[model samples]
Target: MDQRSELSEFLRSRRARLKPEDVGLRDHGRHRRVPGLRREELAQLAGVSVAYYTRLEQGNAQNVSVEVLDAIGRALRLNDIEQDHLTHLAKGKAKKKRAAACRPQQVRPALQQLMDSMDHVPAHLIGRRLDILGWNRMAAALLGDMSQLPPQERNLARHVFLDPASRSLYVDWHGKAIDVVSILRLCAGCYPNDPQLTALVGELSVKSEEFRTMWAAHTVAEKGHGVRRLRHPVVGELTLAYETLKLPDEHDLSLVTFHAEPGSASEESLRLLGSWSADQPVRTG
Candidate 1:
């Protein structure tokens, strides 16, 4: 992907989502050509020159300072994830060349044991491209049997977009799909030259129209702690809160654990699902 073009589009998309009144600016009587605040207005809000902000938005500004970027982020009303994404885009051009082939990341046995110990909490390990590197039995029960899928098909983004079962698995499929695409966009900025990521994006873009449209929006988001409503085949609907923990030493591997509030129906359902998963034959690869 062209980093400059991606950066330009991302900034434009964010800028278009905000209005003059959003930042307490009075709406002028003049007819506006664009949807959001004009370039000059944004520049004024960010305390930068119109020409400099314009150049930054156009992807021509090569030396972006942290303070200036932070000001722009605040002016744009960006969240923490979006702010991080902006920083990534600004620095992405300086990334060195990666290896021709992306190396497969292995889950540590200790980490696997840790996941297994959380018997009631559905947990899984995901690599850079959202690949399901490892998962516990409860995770398999909640999100479908990852062991049944080929390694290449074990990506969360792939399953969310291509797998028909995912439509039934996630209660808010469209919303989840949008979040997945945004996460992928953030990943793309971080690893602009990863061939595997490029291939995955190309494949999904061709296969799913929804994925294609969301991908084109240029939104970027880091995966964070959130609640998800999932429909289990056996246990019906479950409202689970999940936390994404990034492993510092694991080469972009993250452990995502899902659980439910105590004494809730979802908690009971999760316990039942855990029992059911425990009864099934343990899967070995």
Candidate 2:
């Protein structure tokens, strides 16, 4: 997670995904050397000088203004999440602080209690780097026993990419993998010098070729809500709709809750699973 390199690469990757025609620029029928808009073309679209934009893309620009970032974001057709990521990288380019040491994340008591009270729903508290900081019995039953894993290994990214069980658990395994990589990419932009994140990314990159490829794509996303189809070992196949609830005071923590549609087979299966695992212990990392 070299911040400067990440900033430059993120910009290049974003630029490489666009075409002149995509941005309302007509091609003059001349042979183009690159896949996307040239630097000068982008500079013109952003209403900035070529030299300035080139320096910005190279991660050498100092005192970058938010207005310029906004202009470049609009020119590149970046979404709200992508725009925030770009701004984070751009703002972090001038930092000189050393990466903070890795430490165990603590789950708040109130949050843990709330998750535990959700007896019928699968719920977990996710910390920085998608770490499963705390989980109730239902979550353990649905997503596997996180208590069996080491502290550092209790992460969603690790489950999605490194664990074989996840491939069977998730019907859309590839889509889940893509979402994990995209979420990690967005986190990387925000926590540029996080040592734990650096280690997690390195481990996944080494163990999973798919992770490597997706990481190179530099897609970024902030997961809000989604549907997940799971093939549970005990309950059989079930589809669940999930929503992310960001903790108000804990900026780095989110409570994820999943529920099946009312009166559906999936709902029955989920209830069955919950009833079957009622005695299991909650996993609090």
Candidate 3:
């Protein structure tokens, strides 16, 4: 994807979503030819010249300062994630190094052991592009069996968008799909040159209309601790709180673990799932 084009479209889309009355600008009952706030109105709100703002939106501005980006973010009513995305786009690629491929890092034996020790909790390790680098037995039991999937198909985004089982696994499938796309957008800004990521995005865009629409929205988000509602094929519906922990000394690896609330039916279901996972025949390598 062309960085300039991405930046331009993102800004235009954001601008088109807001109205004059949204930013305390009075509508003088004038007929408007354009959607949202006009370029001059946004420039006035951002305390910049209309020419400068126009140049920035046109992707012609060079070395855009953080202050100016922040000002524009405020003018556009961007949230924290959106403001960060604006900064990332406006900062350009001069200071950033590109990764060639979105490959999963080697899973350390100690890390694998630690995950295996979490007998009840469903734990998994994800690398860049949300690839399922490694997963424990409980995680496979809770989610789908990732071990059965080909390495190239082990991405969470791909599973959410392309796999039929994901719709049944996630109780809030639509919300999860949006979150996956937003997280992918955030990754795209961080790793613009990753060939695998580019391929994955292109494939999803072509195959899934939902993915294409969400991708075009240019939403960005970071994975964080949250409650998830999942419907396991065997265990039925479960409400679990998940925590995302960044691995030490690893820039792109994160360990995600899920825990059920104590005294809840979900807790009992998790225990049953754990026992079922243990009873299953282990694959001999």
Clashing pairs counted in every model? 0, 0, 0
- Point out where model 1 deviates above 4 Å: 93-101, 282-285
Worst 10 residues of 1 by lDDT: 92-101
What's the TM-score of every candidate structure?
A: 0.91, 0.94, 0.94
Top candidate on lDDT is 2
lDDT of 2 by residue, 180-203 (tens): 899889888877777788999999
Task: Give the alpha carbon lDDT tens digit for every residue of 1-285 in model 3.
Answer: 667777888888889888988999997998988888888989999999999999999976587888999899999999998887777777865236474343446789889889888889999988888888888888888887777777878889998999999999999999999888988888787777777888999999999999999998888888888999999988889999999999779867889999999999999999999888898754210
Instruction: Report model 1's TM-score to 2 decimal places.
Output: 0.91
At residue 7, give the lDDT of candidate 2. 79
Q: Which stretches of candidate 3 lie over 4 Å from their true place?
A: 93-95, 100-104, 282-285
Pairwise lDDT winner, candidates 1 and 3: 1
**Candidate with better lDDT, 2 vs 3:** 2
For model 3, where is the 10-residue window of minimal lDDT? 94-103
